[model samples]
Target: MSMGRARSVVLIGMEGHLIEVEADIGQSLPAFVLLGLPDAALRESQDRIRSAAKNTGIELPRRRLTINLFPASLPKSGSSLDLSILVAAWAAEAHVAGTAKVVFLAELGLDGRLRPVKGVLPAVRAAAQAGAETVVVAAENAQEAALVRGVEVLAAEHALQVASYFRAPGAVEVPADPAQEIQRVTPGSPHAEPSAGGEAAKDLADVRGQAEARFALELAAAGGHHMLLMGAPGAGKTMLAERLPSILPPLNEEESMAVTAISSISSGAASVTRLQRRRPFEAPHHSATAPSLLGGGSRIPGPGAVTRAHCGVLFLDEAPEFPRSVLDSLRQPLETGRITLHRSAGQVTYPARFQLVMASNPCLCGLNVGSGTQCSCTVAQRRNYLYRLSGPLLDRIDLQVQVERPHSAALALQQPGESSAEVARRVAQARAVQTERLAAFGLSLNAEVPMNLLSEQLRLPSKEVRALDAALDRAQLSLRGYVRVLRLAWTISDLFLKDHPEADEIDAAMVLRQSAGVRT
Candidate 1:
């Protein structure tokens, strides 16, 4: 009973490890010592803990102090353990006599102030999952922890307050209702606007008219297809890509969590203070590297732009400006819908099922035969630049649009074209139709419709079907491209409320597929 000892769980990133805090009080020795492979930050906790306990009017036991974070094999990191270690030592020194009902998870400041700890939300949820009953955390992080239902959390601002709560019984003030804060929701939605990777949250109305371009954007979202927009510098390429998210649907609960998880692990990036509501919109600069685009690092591997854009849109303006290798790195995630960051700690796979919207010029000079201006770039330079976007990558893009400068009339005729909500209504309908069609096969959208599904399940009418066969033969469309066109056709038909693509839809889809050829 003379030994000062308490136990708590230590969280490292998303992982949790149980730690034992033991104290031996004797007249012989008067010093503090911590063991169990503590890192620099954890080791320095000695000063913070002592100062915090003293400020809270509790004396630090000077006899012999020992702390042990169990599962000694798992590397212990961060200051989330401060609360637990403090509680354990206090309970032992005060001789609480068989007290064992609560657990602590927080960081303590030397001033006795309770500070918010990173990844505590994940840790609190993990505790509930592991069947722990009571969790006490920093008052600052109560709201985040409260999101995990059925877990009773006690939040305190100072060490003194936390100690008082355990010694007595009272309704300690905790996080308030987060819902009361009015959020800038995507139009017509009853949810908060998401920050990390989201639907532009911007509307299509701001963009001058590009009727065909807007149509292409709708088709891209409907079919779950990647697109390439080629035009001169002044053309509406970037605007169209930005508006792509407006037509796209918002993320579901699971998708939101997946996005939050990757954002949480991003190095040098702070954890998301709240769950994002809108779909993510990431437009990395032309200077991004392959590893930054995908995922890799020296100590802890984190998700790249591709994974960060999971369940959202990844916009690459000046697409060709990105190094050939960087642009090519996306090929895997496009097909796999996930990216794995291989590190010495092991590979961490993050979800990357995002819609790709890429924009590039028709030539190196930013002008070409299609540009309203004269073409001045030499053929060799154009060829070299175009060649960079070879078959391996071009084959993946389902729709190719030659975005052009808006006509004066179109630009002036902004009669409030459409809000993200209106277009989202149609896109959601098309997605629903695709979901029903592919339910048995577990596919979500037309773009994901495998070649086998086209040939075997959703076969086209014989006459319209014959047209596709002849067209593919003459065009030499690869098997993958063939599937892509059919998927696009299905989406076009769905938009028009048709059960299947008619001959007209299939023809139109293929033309959109092969239009403007490659950007080169």
Candidate 2:
């Protein structure tokens, strides 16, 4: 009997665990046994590895072979560990050495080629954290895996190259094509190509009128506040919502990594080539289910639209048309900025911090605005339409602006409105102010500040917040609404270059909060 060991990583959401792959060959029937609770995709890797070994000019001993993954209690899934299993089986047959400390991550083809896998960035990061110095991945994942510091990445195109690197006896060598050869990748290496820049930000200059709605968009961008737009159809609500990402500031390095990692897990390896600095914008259809928004799957839990929109925007157009359960599922993540999904396998938590933007028409007939002229819907119908969005969900939204249809004169004006660049500059400055003020509290935006922190560390004077206190007493605003109003006031103050919120800012924030009354 001979035994060989290798290493790999298993990713659970963005978290990863180092797994040891051990292969044992003994004098028994010609059969293979795989241990460790593996999902269906992983169970099929045995056939894939056997075919890959045969095509790579390596022969396996026709004896009983047993492969086991350590930490048997941990559920393993995906084909990313196929390379490590092949390596361990070969080592057990050829008596090869020196594979205990390196991590192998890739899918194996029947033709012996290596294929890229998703979550390489987070997997490599976890391996580096676990003290693994070297990681082998497919060429397509080289740039992404190299994003992690303190790790050497070996990019290979075929299983033979990795076998040769490990000095396995009788390994075949292919033609010396530069593209297929093994390449070493390191952090910030010039050899890795940069991402093809994404589409240009949509400019706000195209918008005609609705200055109040534009200002609300600015406040939402600056403070990371949630917003709702209520109006008739063709009132430019969708256009305005689409332009929100244009005015938001680019993500910092740490934020970029977090966003890129989540994107990789959700999309795949091909979706990301480098750390993306732009914030994500996710717009799911009204047909989307609660699990799709909250990240749940039949077997493995995956990131939902909320997780994909982390540090970015989650725009829900036709918000009232969506199911009430789906809309209300966002209540917890909106307040806590994190979501935990439970399945029979286990539970995984992902960051759900994002700016929420919902656009809705005033009534089912879409004619309730502007004196309710030519309206055909009953009073109960309009109320029920708005009630689709529960009061609790509406309270979480900070800016509830009513977007009126612009006049023909405003649309016909030849001159364009303010450009995205100009608005983004102001948004960036306001964000900088919030970052500086909240650094001590381990927060970044006005929307993220806790109630206790607002009451104690950054409280307003009694006179400045007198109106809000009165509203709380009158039951016009809940305790949560009062805290949100305080946050919006601070954001308004930052926008106008005020050191602290004053009475003017407080009243403006309250007006924005109460603009689109639920009872309307």
Candidate 3:
């Protein structure tokens, strides 16, 4: 009887904790005991590990065996630790060489095959950060684990392959399975290929008219600000929102990895092969519940639409039709750029720094805005319908624009406005200017700049300041509204290539703020 040890990782949300796997064998009645706070899936791994070891020509001694996950209070979950536990148990009775410096991450099939598991990228990252010398993963996850530099990745298809690799270095080679072997790549590697048939080619020119809405969309894209579009049905509100992503700048390498990782975990994969630079866009239905939008689960809280839309857009059509509670759930993430879910098990936080775009009709009838004659609802009814959107929630939106129906003449002409490519060029230029200016503060866009920084360092001229002061004195804007307008002003300045916002820019921002159909 002997003792053996190995290492693995436990993923809690996106973070990973390195764990030590220890196995002890003793001469007693045949029994296997597992210690540490393990979830149901993990508890069942003992059966799988035993079957896999037997199938792979390795025999466990017919004696009392104990497996203990060190840091037992950490609450380990999932089947990813199967390989580590099996290796440790095998090493207890055999002379397995070179098994000291490698972390194992894979599920063991009953037939001794290695199966891929989720969160391998983050797990490998954690191991690397903890100074692990090497990582062993399934062949399906080899490319993903290879993304983390400074660690040697050994990928195998079966338990026998792993054992052979450890017993004699360079003895076992990864089997060539074209369908399963994703090409190895490192983060920011030039060899990384873009997704095929990437996001459908949406163009802004599809919309007939509503120049005001088009301008607002551009501003939102330029500064990464939240926006609202109010119009009657068939007034191009949805079209404008759908095309907004087309004109936004492509995500950088760091942002791409982050967005990709969230999508991977949400889809139950270690990594997605088709990585794209295009930003994510999510439009959950109005009937979505608070948990679906903010993320919740009985055991591990998953990322919701807001978190999935990180560094991108989250659009809500028919915004007023959504429940008040669901709408209110966004307030915290909007302010802090992240969502924290406190479940009975524990708390998990996910990044939700997304631009919000909401659209709704002016009234319940969907025709009250165009002509009062076509509306059947009374004034009070119309007011109450819009009143569903509370003041604090509306205050968080920076741009509010009224989208009117296009004139008959404009529709007949069918003249397309600027294409997405043309608008995207200007938006990218404006974003570059903002990034350069705000890099010192660790900010990337005007919307994220703090109010104090705006007042102390990014303030406008004296005349513009006095104009804003007069507007504040008249109670035309709240303090929060004031800061939002200033942020919008900066966006306007950046769009027009100005050193700083002036009276004209401030006035433009005020126009947007006052366009909120419902008065605060």
Candidate 4:
């Protein structure tokens, strides 16, 4: 019997585990058996590898072929192992010696073409972490694989390319630097691309009025606070929510890579050519199930809308229209900034740190606080309609502003409101101030500051503290609500370039916290 081994990575959630693929040709019946805890897709890779080898003019031994994936207890899924299996089988037949030094990650086509697989960036990172000197991926994934430093990447278009490299390891060529490749394709600073839904990117200047709503949106963007916009049907709530990304600052390099990795895995694309610095925004429909919103699958836990909006914005229009169960599932992630999905297989934690913006009508009839009341709903109906949003969830939201329809005179004015650029400049300044002040605590925004840290480390003036204590004495704010109000007060202070929050800033924060709709 002759045996050969190669390496690949198996992705479990965002993490990757190095897997050894060993192929053996024994003196038995001419059959193939794969041994490992493989999913359905991986169990079926034998035919793909065989066809690709034959099409690439490589002959496999006709004897019984057995492939074993070491660390046999790890559950391996996906077709990313096809390239490694083919390489190991060929090495066994060819008596090659250097296949173990490199990691392989690509799907194989029947025509011997190397197909790109998802999560290539994280997979390559894992390989580097495991001390692999080189990685082989499909041509399309070369840029993504090369994103990891300290490792050489080889790009292959067909199985023959990999075969050639293995046949003469010294003569193989290295792929181009990923930085250069990315710059060639995208020639400027990272920016936000149009959303996948094909909606034109909205701007803040489009709205004619609702200055209070606009200010609330800016504050939410500045502090990364969760907000609720309550208005009538035609009050431009959706407009303000959609334009939020434009006013938010672009993500830093580390955040961009993190966001890109999540998006690449979710979309099954190995590489993101245009690495966007703009924060992501996901808006799911009200009919979305809890699993779809929170990310659950039959076997592997998929990323839901909450995860996709990591380091970005998650907007839910018609917030009260969603099921109470679905809304309640967000409580844990909101407080912790991460979601741990537990399944029979295992548990995976995904980043769910996002600015949540929810919009809802004041009542079922949508005229509870609008200019003209044509409502026929009773008090009980109004209370029940708004009560669909639980107190716990409402308490997590820092700003709850009332959005009103534009007046006739305001709509008729020719002058536009503050453009997104102008508002984004102010937001950026506020964010920078917070970043500098909170760097010692390892926090970038006021909203992310823990309640204990805010209360203990941050000191407010005596007047401001007295005002907040008075509000607390009145039973207007819950314990959780009080902390959120303090965070908001800090954000307001940052915006005005104040060293600390004054009494007026505290009052503004309290107003923002206790605006319209049902309060916690």
Off-target runs (Cα >4 Å) in candidate 4 are 95-97, 168-200, 370-372
- Candidate 1: give the clashing pairs: 4-23, 194-277, 197-279, 197-280, 197-281, 198-279, 198-280, 198-281, 199-279
* TM-score of every prediction relative to native: 0.86, 0.94, 0.90, 0.91
Candidate maximizing lDDT: 2
Top candidate, metric TM-score? 2
lDDT of 4 by residue, 1-520 (tens): 2888899999887788999999999988888899989889998998998898778777677889999998999999999999999888877776345897679999999988899999887788888999998888887887766666677777777877677656734432323222322111111213213223223467888978788889999999999899999988999999999999989998877887778778768886654644557789999999988888878896779889989999889899999999999999999888887888999998888888888999999999898885436877898899899899998899778889989888988888866999998999999999999999999999989988888887788977577778888878899777787888899999999999999888888889888787774676
Please estimate how well model 3 matches the true structure, expressed as its whole-model Cα lDDT.
Answer: 0.84
lDDT of 1 at 38: 73
Error of 1 at 363 (Å): 1.5
Task: Please provide, for model 2 over 23-118, each residue's C-alpha lDDT reduced to its tens digit, 9 standing for 90 to 100.
Answer: 999899888899999888999999999999888877667889899999888999999999999989888876355887789999999988999999
- Tens-place lDDT per residue, model 3, 376-408, is 889998999888888789988889888888999
lDDT of 1 by residue, 18-66 (tens): 5656655556576767777677788888889999887767767667776
Model 3 ranges with Cα > 4 A deviation: 168-197, 274-276, 440-442, 465-474
Query: Candidates sorted by lDDT, descending order?
Result: 2, 3, 4, 1
TM-score of 2: 0.94
Q: After best superposition, candidate 1 residue 180: deviation in angstroms?
A: 23
**Could you give the candidate ranking by TM-score, starting with the highest?**
2, 4, 3, 1
What would the TM-score be for candidate 3 when compared with the true structure?
0.90
